[model samples]
Target: MQTVELTVRRTVGRSLVFQTKVLEVDANRDDPTIVVACPEGLDPLEHHFDASIAWTSALGRMEYAVTTRPERRGRGRVWLLTLTGPLTGVQKREYFRADVSIPVVVSWTDGPPAVSASTNGTEPQTHRLAGVVLDLSEGGVLASVSGVPPPVGTQVQSVLRIDDDEIVHAATVVRHVSLAGGTGVALAFADPSLHGDRLRQVAFEAERKRRRGD
Candidate 1:
């Protein structure tokens, strides 16, 4: 009886996110379905509405997209979610890393690049560098930048364009390596702020597209 997080969103409303216990997994059927104990007082989930489920596993957080329906069993209601796609394995950090190439702009406050100016209570000068995000995850991104790369531990801001959406994140340079044309650096998000869900969705979609060779 493992606990899993469930999220359901109607086409025109906010998402419903809650924790539920896994009751059963029926994988033998044409469309595998997972049965989970419904939370008390929850409205019946919209029939065949899309849902996302996540559970922590030994490898990491695992996520799945499903079509949900309410079912009755011995007077207790349960959620029957049919698998709509392959399970996505998020890493130990609870974020799925996607291999992608997208344009990015990394900026840092001028001065000691390692120290954020907000800590000193002074108006900070800013500098920007153009880069291409080689890979992205909910927690961070690996990017290739021409010219000099920022040192490890430097705090910076990044703007990433994915499709028609633009995401901005406060990040710290975590790792770097020399490359033939430029330097590759990894920036871990310091705080995802209001864009956490957006980041996860983007990473998931990118991973799915990669798997499908799209």
Candidate 2:
């Protein structure tokens, strides 16, 4: 009964096709076929067109090709897609990355434990690094901060605002570089399945808006 968020795309020849989300579907079983409830107005013309579905699992990112079955099921908008190949593991770099500048706050997880500041032991004090996200992807982000970044393997938590939504992610420092007046650090999301979809959506929208010159 577990549900998974899926990004489904359909393509024809070399040109890119429509991209949509599998709104309501649980793909936990090992069955060869899966039932997906897609959003309205997503009917493809070809019954057997080639498609690909990508989702994040506990193992990692995975994707596989599928073909749509002409037959429909369920009461509402649903489509039956049959697996055409085995699932393939995807690398973090394969995720779509967007170049953007967003404000971020990085909290060092390995820093000193929070201690009470007041005599009554009510107020706690902790240190945080303020940074700007230079670029973003579903897998990770590159940020520039005022202070020296932690070691490459350091663990940190980041809070950033994407449009009107504020997102917090637990991440690890994958790469660090010293800038002219600041430090640049790359952070990889520890639990991508929790917020990967939201990041992907934001990146995609940003790319679209850029193309439209908005």
lDDT by residue for model 1 (1-214), tens: 7766677776865566665778888889988889988754467654746888986554668899988888888647888988888978677755556677889999987653355566765555777889998877667889999767778999998999878877898899999977678899899998743576666666655655554456
Question: Model 2 misses residue 3 by how many Å?
Answer: 6.9
**How many clashing pairs per prediction, in order?**
0, 0
- What does candidate 2's lDDT look like per residue over 95-212, in tens digits? 6666788899888755345556754343333458989988887788999998767778877899988778779999998998766778899999987767877787666656545544
Off by over 4 Å in 1: 1-94, 112-125
Candidate 1: clashing pairs of residues: none
Clashing pairs in 2: none
How far in Å is the alpha carbon of 191 misplaced in model 2?
Answer: 4.1
Q: After superposition, how far is residue 206 of candidate 2 from its true place, in Å?
A: 5.2
